[model samples]
Target: MSHENKTIRNTAPGHPRRPLADRIALVAGATRGAGRAQAVELGRAGATVYVTGRTTRTRVSEVGRTTETIEESAELVTAAGGTGIAVPTDHLDGERVRALADRIDREQGRLDVLVNDLWGGEHLLVGSVFGKKSWETPLADGLRILELGVRSHVITAALLLPLLIRSDAPLYVEVTDGTAHSNRRYRENMYYDLAKTAPIRLAFGLGQELAEYGGTAVAVSPGFLRSEQMLAHFGVSEENWRDAIAQEPAFAVAESPQYLARGVAALAADPGRAARWNGKSACSAELARAYGVRDVDGSRPDAWAYFEAAAHGGEEVSPEDYR
Candidate 1:
């Protein structure tokens, strides 16, 4: 991918097809998972989207172990409707993120939406006691997760704040794993817990800071995201993913990355989103009710509700009741 955010004109199927027409958005870490889905959804809604990640067709990031590339995500965004530009960037590097800002200024003039979904801690989760005990885990591994999962987001927001503030009602989305209440308990792993929870606080902080400027920030948590990484780890495809439920009971209510993407798009589309949701954390089910969008299966899965009561609270969860 080039540093120049060139416009790509291609067609993708399954467009949600709303009217973001002249809107411009950036999805950091858009190689795969929620990042890719959010980028594509923004494009489907008719917004020019800049898709950024370290993984490109030529090379892969150390944190990711797959063939997925930011170029592919950009192409999908183009196919959906709006222009998609791929930019390979490591958010941890200040100069790299600064260059992204310069490029956006040169290419698009300003940014209307920003989704900070940079999480590449997957490599640390395997064979390691990542969640069982924080201090027991390797210090190097723990620090690495904080660097990739948390610090990158902090750096990105600082650099891009200028572009974001230029918009009429800029929407800043901090993508985390769980809601504030849901993540109250230690997330089985210390480093992972800190990495995920920081974004929620970041959103609240940004919300308070950006209010007078007509910008809104909200931390968005996805419920049991059936992301590409999750699918591969479970050794199952989307069609046969039910097999994973047998292996882990929590998989029963898992939703796709698109579910959260829809939530992001809905928040961006709402005119009063800044007033209504500023400083708060949001979920897919909440957005579905507000925006009236559903998943690919035409059902809105409330994974967090089911997960909270079933997985953690020891209550039986019905898919219909939650969805």
Candidate 2:
């Protein structure tokens, strides 16, 4: 409990310290869902966050998904207690990505955290790609999925890594879907599997080089995230998320995106964070145990542990043990 005073773990009404004060962070793909949560949570810990994505208040990206905008994400970050700057730029475009880095350098001078949360492959995830054989899947769609899910992450990191390196304590988080253990089961098809696992390898390879510059790189997974997209998919609001259990029983284990992002904030706040988590693939559930964060309901939900035992292992264990 050493970080009890530093984190919002047990102190609730008594604790009032923001451990990440003055920290500068960039959360790519912060238009909504996990990315937005990560940005807001970082701001909650007092970090000036640059929330970037292709969508804005005025226009949508090529993906054409509307409703949530980067501008709104930035406003939420600012409301959470830190300065938030909304920059609309597609990560795939090299010039636009570099320009974003330059703007950060001019405004903040240093970046402490770089979160590669940009993934535009939602269509491939739940679309016709599922259950369709690799040979039968549309070639263009498969390539598009790879381009968004894998390449965007690489492009963003390449342009932003220099700014992150300037900070004394830098953290690069590859926000992904599943942990190393879980992803071994295969994610949909060839394209989806490669896209999801590429970031894990990206974090690993980057960790080795980052060691020289005193930086940390890790891939973090959110367990059954009830993201904005997921809520829309299930046709349930946060207050009515439980209702989705009728449609998909597995949804019973779903956790809010805020829970996962809080774990990211805790990782950024830990001074010895690199020593423990560099090059690692961690889940939000376990991180919540180590950190002092909770879901929207104020409970630390260990969704992965529950998944491991009940879903994967088929072991009958008390739900209380995991959550």
Candidate 3:
């Protein structure tokens, strides 16, 4: 399918107002999945979006997947009714991130929204990691996860906040794996847990710092996200995703990436977002309830709640109840 068609294929009817019109946003690591969806949703809300990632038409990064690229993400953003600029960047490289910041400052003068969604460590979860103990997991792989999930966000924010603070109502979103409350338990392995939870703490600290400048920072996460990589792991496409539920019943509550994208876009456009979300951690379901957003299928999936019920509650609960 064409980029435009694919981009809008799952988009539901949006708000009538262009709440983010004339605003500028940068979606780091927007080559695919939730990152790409957020870029497109921000664009749909009428913001000029700058998308950055290591993958491009000409080069591929360690993540290894090349089916999606930054150029395509930019096109999808533009096709959704806003300006899109694709800049190939490796967030781990401070020099490259600094150059990106400089370019954005030169072109737009200010950035209203910064989405730090730069994690590509899934490929590193090989035989040594995932279910293995911390000591059993390769030290290199653990460090790499931290580098990709934690260090990259720090680097991007360090370089880009200058331009972001120029806006009157700046918003910074740290996208990670789980909500603050839900992630209290271990997440598969030690390295993975730390890699995911660091963003929440970063958001908490940054929110306090940004408050002086009238900016908001919050951590947002998707619940059972049906990302491109996740779908591939289940060996099913979106069209046949339900097939996997037979093997993994939890998949019944899985949601499209667009669900969280819409929630983040709505949160960005909200006039009182700072008062409601600053320094807080939220999940896609919470954002949906706060913003009156629903998935493209017209359902609000609360995977975390479902999991909680399944784990602790006594009553038999169906996953469909969460959706």
Candidate 4:
């Protein structure tokens, strides 16, 4: 375990606040992308965030990217104004997850927020599942997707919910790829579809159980996110993201990871979140509009809405309108 403990302070000079100062949060699979951003934003709101992933400074997970690690995420969380603890964990391993729960119970006594964002199956998307039929897809790769996206979340929630329920009002966030409304159509492959939709069902089921304890559960999705991997796929960087629009016009509505992070942070800080969001499915755009939050670039992009509109032969409005 690596710890980054700092005296809690304001997020910026002369703007002191700690809306979630007393909160304890665990962000599973926070090595990079949306998970890392979620951890950083929760820390910015003054929550003690435990960032966990299979990757560390000394090791790399099957995702095979070593540029970002859990240790780095913890440091960023601490820099964002809250305590950050990095624990190297494999959510798929039941024993390791149980040990993590025991450690958190020993230290924090209670957990206020649980963000299960443990999907690392992006590498299997290209030739494995996207264009191939289920029968043509590799059996091992198909099953691995389920393990990463669905089983990992189940194990984490099962091991950690005991501590989470101890809180006065717990918040369980199931981070998936699409909203319930958007995923109504087929997602190309059987395994991929099930993996993405499982969290929506999980959130619905958990909401019912958590309601008795004054807890809230919701699944959230980010629109066409311009994550590090996405940028690499387009052969562009954040500063040059607009260049990718020539190849993929839809990229015009792509949002930064910070956009979704801000939305999640606002949701966490909202006093009436249980009444407004419990058992619901939300996207970054919906949360941004609801919370009056904006992306780091000051625009609000609704990629999901834009896609839905385009799917119905409605190209009347440009992608710029969505932003």
Residue lDDT tens for model 1, 1-323: 22233233222323335657778899998999889999999998989999999889889789656579999999999999879999999999999999999999998888889999999888788767444577789889888989987999999999998888777677899998887878887787888889989999999999998886778999988887898889998999888888998888667777888888887887787778888899888887788778888877787888878877776889866755776
Alpha-carbon shift of residue 107 in model 4 (angstroms) = 0.8
Give the Cα-based TM-score of candidate 4 against the true structure.
0.94
Can you give the TM-score per candidate against the true fold?
Answer: 0.92, 0.91, 0.94, 0.94
Candidate 2 vs candidate 4: the lDDT winner is 4
Clash pairs, model 3 backbone? none
Model 3 residue runs over 4 Å out of place are: 1-15, 312-315
Candidates ranked, most accurate by lDDT first: 3, 4, 1, 2
Error of model 4, residue 167, in angstroms? 0.5
Clashing residue pairs, backbone N/CA/C < 3 A, model 4: none
lDDT of 3 by residue, 55-130 (tens): 9999999988989999999999999998899999999999999999999989878788999999998899868688
The lDDT values for all models are 0.85, 0.84, 0.91, 0.91
> lDDT for model 1, on a 0 to 1 scale?
0.85
In angstroms, the error of model 4 at 145 is 0.5
After best superposition, candidate 4 residue 112: deviation in angstroms?
0.2
User: Which whole-number lDDT from 0 to 100 does residue 109 have in model 2?
Assistant: 82
The regions of model 2 sitting more than 4 angstroms off are 1-16, 316-322
